[model samples]
Target: MPWVFLVIAGLLEVVWASLMKESHGFTRFWPSLGTLVFMAGSFGLLAVAMRTLPLGTAYTIWTGIGAVGAFLVGILWLGEPAGALRLLAALLIVSGLVLMKLTSGH
Candidate 1:
């Protein structure tokens, strides 16, 4: 299903973003390669999903997943502070994505 592909693409967005950070501006070798691979895969799948899904809804969900995922990784693994407000903001992102999906009428 297109939704399945979209969700996978969204998760790949997260992986690619995290790998991009690990890539050290593409200075590192392995992480850089991984970033490229995941980035391609993410976009490819997103395009597939876009064949049926509304463009704005699909794009918002993709970036929302990437943003929330990267933020959580920063807090949990990268030593960024996990403050209450930060957590709330992440929740807000998810909430917005859900509303968008619901109202997209796809």
Candidate 2:
């Protein structure tokens, strides 16, 4: 399903983002290569999902998932700040994504 591909793409966003950090400005060979591969795959999946899913809704969900997932990864793995404001912002993005999904009826 398109939604499935979108979810996979979103997860790949998280993967690529984490790998990017490890890439160190593309100086690290392995992580940089991994990041490139994942980024391409993520976009490929997004393109596939767009075939069936509404562009606006699918893009919103994909971006929302990626943003929240990346933020959590930063906080948990990289010791980035996870303050109340950040948590609330992440929750709002999730809420918006859920609302979009609910309204889309798919």
The per-prediction CA RMSD against the true structure, in angstroms, equals 0.8, 0.9
List the lowest-lDDT window of 10 residues for candidate 2: 57-66
TM-score of each: 0.96, 0.95
Cα deviation of 25 in candidate 1 (Å)? 1.2
- Model 2 lDDT on a 0 to 1 scale: 0.93
TM-score of 1: 0.96
- lDDT per residue as tens, model 1, 1-106: 8888988998998898999999999999999999999999999999999999999999999899889989988988899998899999999999999999899898
Error of 2 at 91 (Å): 0.3
Cα lDDT of model 2 by residue, 14-48, tens digit: 99999999999999999999999999999999999
Off by over 4 Å in 1: none
The pairs that clash in candidate 2 are none
Positional deviation of residue 13's Cα in model 2 after best superposition, in angstroms? 0.4
TM-score, predicted candidate 2 vs. hidden true structure? 0.95
lDDT of each: 0.93, 0.93
